[model samples]
Target: MLEHAFVDQDGLHDFVFGGDGLSSRYDCLVITSQRAVEAVGAVLARAPSAAARARVLAMPAYTVGPATAALLASVGFSNVLGAGDAGNGSVLADIIVADATRQGALRCIFFPGRVRKDVLPQKLRAAAAVECDERVVYESRGVEGADAALRAALDAAGGAAQRAAPRAARTWVVFFAPGGADAAAATVAGRRLPAAAIGPTSAEFLAARGVRAAAVAAKPDPASLLAAIAAADAHDV
Candidate 1:
């Protein structure tokens, strides 16, 4: 069950990500997932729908992946902006900032997770009147199932054990959320796996454990995460 609300918007764009793509659509795209196609639909269906959410769906849908675009089409959002794998907020901010700088209208609605950090929005808002409304569509809390041993195993293998096993190599562990990241960091010492964080705050929390970290995913969005991973991979290679 979820408690949803409809917040009004003033010339803002909605942005969110989950699954493999976007579940919703928007005029100016900033997302990363297939399920984000229904973003506008999901947001509009909430209590007090925003005018931006309603109008953008009717115009064009811009998203980060094919599945999201397809989903948007299935749900009736006609126009879309597809940035493919580059659907993270940083990339989205780049696009939005470019256009906003040109046209001089800087306003956007951010549909983010319950625990999202606001790096991209802050950058964009500095250039324009950014109106962000975060909706807690879902929450990903730390899984209580993880114990000390399991945490050690996960960290040792760099997130997914099987994937990291084959290389017989070192991999970086990226804790996606702050709480879970902190939990994982608390019980460890002399951890071999190099750790990274999805955002600076998570890095700060994890840093208390003597774990050095690099902050990626400036917006706590998957696109940023993926990009950071790719960048790290490149550096590793």
Candidate 2:
């Protein structure tokens, strides 16, 4: 049986929005995750003027994938576009560039997590001369230590022998974010295990810690996670 590692953290709560240069409409609104969409909703909820809210609602919205687009739609964002299955900043940048080339250079506002890569904005500027503004709506912080279940599991798994066991006997741990990787590293304390990551960024985080991921999901979603596990299993075989 696979032992799951859990990181207990205060979920996304800090949100800051509304400032100079922020208006009702933009060429595009880029949201990177469901948390980012939630943050946008929070910002809209606090809008001081109805006209301001209306302006934001009227803007075209874009997201990294269908999941985030669906979340935006649920919150009454009718004009929304998604980059499909491979949801990442890089893919989103490509879509933004292609759209800008066809339609015209666009002014975009980005709602991203606190810890984000500059790839999307850099690509947009380089490929389409698009002007982009960013606001961080949420941040994830790692727990101070492993949760009880994770600690117990690690204890049960024991030392190097278990860590170096055959792939069939090892449970593949899947990390969804860099924070998760940080938590896992703290929890495992140098004990290596078969691991997988949801995307390239998370995989890179693991690699930086000398924990090479067996597989990386094409997208940051549960279905992709399963696919990553299957790929890892195949690699192990």
Candidate 3:
């Protein structure tokens, strides 16, 4: 049985591809979220000609996880990388650096939400031969009431102690992105609820806000995230 309850999150937004056209010569495409893939598809639909769309599709696409890679495949991206093993942005950056080392001077175009962290770009730029262009495909609005939901969850967890629920002492906030963490950090300040980050980027963002995640799941699956949280809960006990 799942020991955790999800806090309510609101205000998800649709995004559009930011670039007017493929202005720069890029060797590969970097896409992180499935939403970004959808945005790119929208851009392709408006392309001047079929050849234009074909050109973008021909470039090797590096995705953060298998889900993103699969979406790229549906959109006609034949050459895909980082679909397996490299589960998070940091690891994907490492894979790109290694692959680029063999190919020499890689030019990368990144499609990400505007609320993203700089870890991926920073790592890519650190390699002297790699240049990354960020195209903000969408804007993400931080949802309010995450802190309030968390507080309510904590209160509920405490009440469950009368029934001796196994998770009474184990309250954690799961953050999928930096935007959510950024929005809720202030309101939840001083509460210090153990947080579980979906990936390294969220963990780093939470850490910078002085709220270090007690558990961080780098893998891009629900089972992996649950396992991370369970292990952390075990350690806390």
The digit string of per-residue lDDT tens for model 2 on 142-206 reads 55444667877766766543656464455666787766776575555466556788878778777
Candidate 3 lDDT, 154-232, residue by residue in tens: 6675455456665555666787767667766654456646678877777878888878788887586566678889999
Clashes of each: 29, 0, 0
Arranged by lDDT with the best first, the candidates are 3, 2, 1
TM-score of each: 0.52, 0.78, 0.78
* TM-score of candidate 3 against the unseen true structure: 0.78
RMSD of each: 8.5, 5.7, 6.5
Better model by lDDT: candidate 2 vs candidate 3? 3
Query: What digit string (tens of lDDT, one per residue) describes model 1 on residues 126-175?
Result: 76533333343444445555565666575556555456545554566777
Model 3: residues with Cα > 4 Å off, grouped in runs:
1-24, 143-154, 161-163, 166-171
In model 1, which regions exceed 4 Å deviation?
A: 1-56, 59-88, 129-133, 152-167, 171-183, 187-189, 196-210, 213-237
Among all windows of ten consecutive residues in candidate 3, which has the lowest summed lDDT? 1-10
